[model samples]
Target: MRRHRRAKIVATVGPASNTPEMLKRLFLAGVDTFRLNFSHGTHEDHAKVHAAIRALEAEMGRPIGILQDLQGPKIRVGTIRDGKITVAAGESIRFVLSGADGDKTAIPLPHPEIFAAVMPGHNLLIDDGRVRVAVTGLGDDYIDAKVVIGGTISNRKGVNLPDTVLELSPLTAKDRVDLAFGLELGVDWVAMSFVQKPADLLEARGLIGDRAGLMSKIEKPAALDRIDDIIRLSDSVMVARGDLGVEIPHEEVPGRQKELVRACRLAVKPVIVATQMLDSMVNAPTPTRAEASDVATAIYDGADAVMLSAESASGAFPVEAVEMMDRIIRSTEQHKLYRSIIDASDPGEEQTAPHAVAAAAADLAEVIHASTIVAYTSSGTTAARIARRRPAVPILAITPHAAVSRRLSLLWGAHSVLSADIHTYEEMVERALGFAKEEGFAKPNDQMVVVAGIPFAKAGTTNNLRVVQVEG
Candidate 1:
């Protein structure tokens, strides 16, 4: 089934939508891709979900991408003696580097990295900022802090240090194991969380190799300083605004999100704006007006996809949330403002043959009023370049690689399909024409702008563009 809107939706699979029947409903509801959150479920649970998704893909005859979001280094306070505690503002507390339970006077901050990285005056936000503490003194194994803002500090609550840049790998030990399992499961993408630098991508890439696409989760302030390098190194990026909003000022998130989306567009990398797009839909059947506007704003900013976390994973109304998001996107795209913004954002001069060819195909499609811009790609790069142009017509990406086809599903305006490798130019055109017609993207006598490389099956070699008419 084709969506009327260009932007895609990524729905997370969880207890609320893990059943095969529910998964199918979500797919039909307009979910372009499924996110397997490694942070929550067990390996067996995720494997089951993965198997169900593939089964659905086979039954529907469509390419659906699965993203394994690795749980990076998440630091949290250790257990408390009474399961929770309330510290009064202006009270002093000690964070000892131990794993044992503690009383009101102190608590265990078991992560050595955080203890090592933190310094005097650094603020520690606990339990999602409900409790705050400013470090007054630091030692090799403990921190003496004064409570700036106090509330209930529960057992093993999450800890966020906005000022400290811990010297840690983006992938935790659990993440490495999860990555191995996901790769074995044949997931299309691996989203590395809390990526602080470009080098964080290298280690994951080394492990991933060519097995899966690597996506950086941009959530840290340090990541913003190296956004370009991170985007260049990774296959794609996810603007993870959850931790980002916590680490940085909440007001700065919108501007940072716009910058990241625009940068990814310029670089032709698929970018997903994630975290709480339809958060309220997690409980309520309908989304708030502010939430609808938020999703629309992302589409207007040219994001490739907007993601739903708890809304689709563990929400009370998973299908409704997807349908609501779909409606918002379609309605937003119909507005003249959306089109004008997309048209105005130019990706500068073309640098490669594929870039020029993709640009020419988009231009030709608009000029000739073609039914579609069909791209023959092996690595999905050509299709991405065409998508970056924000063409008026839909993009039909025909690929021989199943992974490439699935990955392209996350791209804006890209409708991906897998086929056998074509060896000749005539075969390429014929395949494009056949799929365009069979998929109901075009009819006989309809014009199509096709782009591909001269040497078939070789990746990143898109250097040709042709205007072809479907033969009657």
Candidate 2:
């Protein structure tokens, strides 16, 4: 089934929507990608879900994307003597690097990396900034800080150091195991979290290679300074506004989100605006008006996709959330100002032969009012290049590799299908026309623009273009 809209929906699969029947319903409701969060589930839990998705994909005859989201290094407080302890504002608290239970006088923070990197003026956000403290003194094993905000500090609550960059890899011991397991399962995308700098992507890349698209999650404030480099190194990017929202000032989240989305578009890579898009839908069947606007805002900003976290993962109404997000995307794309905004935000143009060809194809399709623009891709590059132009016509991305087709599920304006590689130019035209009519992108008399590489089954050879008629 072809989706009427161009922007795709990514929904996290969790306890609320993991059943085979429910998964089918969610897919039919318009979920392009399913994120398997490794942070909360066991290996066994994820494998079953992965198998279910593959089975559904085979049954539905669509390439569905599976994203394995790794939980990076999490710095948390040690156990508390009582279940929780409350600290007052302006109170001096010493955080000792010990695993022992903590008391009011000294809070035990077991992570040495935090102690090593934190400076005297750095702010430490605990339990999601409910308890805020600024470092006033430091030692080899202790950090003395004045609590800026007073709240209860519970055992093992997460710690966020916004000002300090820890000398730690994004992949922890648990993440390594999870990565191997997800790779073995043949995941389509691996979303690495806690990415501080561009170098954070290198280690994950070494392990991932070309198996799956490596998507770096922008959750740290430091990543904002070198976003262009990070986008270049990454296969895709995700504006994970959860931890990101907590680490930076709340007022700056919106600007950062827009900045990250624009940077990804400039780099010609897919970007997903994630976290709290439909939060109220977690318990209700419908989303709040503000949440609806949030999803629309991302679409207006030309983000490739918008995501659902707890709304679809553990929410009471999972399918409803997906349908709401689907409706919002379709409505926003149909807005009168939507195209103008996207056209104005177009990253000028890339200076390359392939990009030139793609741009020419896009302009030709708009000029001739073609029904569809077909791109014969092997690595999905040809389709991505063309889709980046945001052509008025729908894109039919024909690829032989199932992996490539699945990954294209995240790109903007791409409706991908799997087919055998075509060797002859004439054969390519014949197959494209047949697909256009069969996929409902065109009628018998409608014209379609075809863009394909000269060397068949090769990547980065997107130079050929043709205008062809669909035969009955």
Candidate 3:
């Protein structure tokens, strides 16, 4: 069965809602995707969750996407010697970086790369910006910063440096191991955190090697700077607004989110708007009015998905959050503007063979007022190309591989059908059209546009297109 809504809900898995029974309830509540955060859980723990989800999939007889999120290069303060440091506002407190067992300073600077790259006048936010520090001077072994705004600093508080780029690789050692585990586990998607360049995506994709699609999280300022390149390199993109908001001006995040979503759509890659969506529902049963509007905006902005963080993972209301998200997705999609945005992507020029074939299929569907558009894709690429056009009719993507079927579950307007291998382009189209007709998804008189590739065309390469009428 195909999902009716477009804005898919991605619920995070956490300690509060990790049981198999709870996961099943979440699936029933309309969660299209499950986000397994690699930062918190052990590999064994994730393995258990993976098993449980697969069991649910077997029972329900439907595909559910699993996204593995890697913790990429997280910078935090070292241990505080006194365990706590209370500084009043306007009080000048010194932040010292020393190898002295972290016992002398109010907050020990653990990341030496941050100190080396930091210059005077740069601002450092600690504990989620509750405390602010301004670099005043650079020392031989340590960097000194004066507390411009001080608050009580605790152990291992989060540090945010907006101005300076730390000389660090996007993937940490832990991320590499986690990615390997995800590949072995056969997850549907892998989300790389703090991706700053296309090279980061290339490295991850090389490791993944088509086992799972790479999703770049736009959370760093450097990432925002190179978003076009990142979008081109990655299979999908996510607007990770949490750390992104901290890194950039708060007022600019909303615009950035829209821009990023549009860019991904033009590139024909699915984009997810994530972080703090339905966050207030973590404790409260009902979301704030503003939060509801935020979700609607994401849908209106043409995002393929909207994600939930603590709302479904550790919140008091996990199932309720999913249900609410489902309702909002359906409701927002009813708007006339929603379809406009979906159809607003940059259409490919009918020049290249693949582009010409994809465009012709879309055009034929529109000309014949077809009820269904069937695109036979081996790698789910040609189907995605057609989906980027956002034709008004439904897209039926037939593939032989089960992995490709599951991955297409996250793409917009694509209903994937797993079928036996067809040797020729005509056989692929006939199989797809026959399936659509046999399932009563389309009537006898319904028309459809069929797309495949020429002789010996590899998967993901489409060089043929045809318009066919379903025989009675």
The top-ranked prediction according to TM-score is 2
Residue by residue across 393-434, what tens digits does model 3's lDDT show? 778888778788777877877777878777875676668678
Task: State, as a TM-score between 0 and 1, how close model 2 is to the true structure.
Answer: 0.99
Largest lDDT belongs to which candidate? 2
Each model's lDDT comes to 0.92, 0.93, 0.81
Each model's Cα RMSD: 1.5, 0.9, 2.4
Q: Model 1: which residue pairs collide?
A: none
Per residue, candidate 2 scores C-alpha lDDT tens digits across 1-472 of: 9998989999999999988999999999999999999998899999999999999999999999999999999989988987799899999899999857788667999888888889999999999989999999999999999999999999889999999999989999999999999999999999999999989999999999999999999999988878888999999999999999999999999998888888888788999999999999999999899999999999989899999999989999999999999999999999999999999888878899999999999999999999999999999999999988888799999999999999999999999998999999889999999898889999987889999998888998999999998776
| Candidate 1 lDDT tens digits, 1-472 | 6778899999999999999999999999999999999999899999999999999999999999999999998888999988988998999999988857787666998989987789899999998788989999988888999999989999889998888888899988899999999999999999999899888889999999999999999998889998999999989999999999988889999999999999999999999999999999999999899999999999999999999999999999999999999999999999978878888876575687778888888988999999999988899998999998999899999988999989998999999988998888789888888899888899989999988887888888988888899887
TM-score of each: 0.97, 0.99, 0.92
Off by over 4 Å in 3: 88-91, 100-106, 344-351, 438-440
For the record, the alpha-carbon RMSD of candidate 3 to the native fold, in angstroms, is 2.4
Ranking by TM-score: 2, 1, 3
In model 1, the runs with Cα more than 4 Å from the true position are none
The superposed Cα distance between candidate 1 and the true structure at residue 257, in angstroms, equals: 0.7
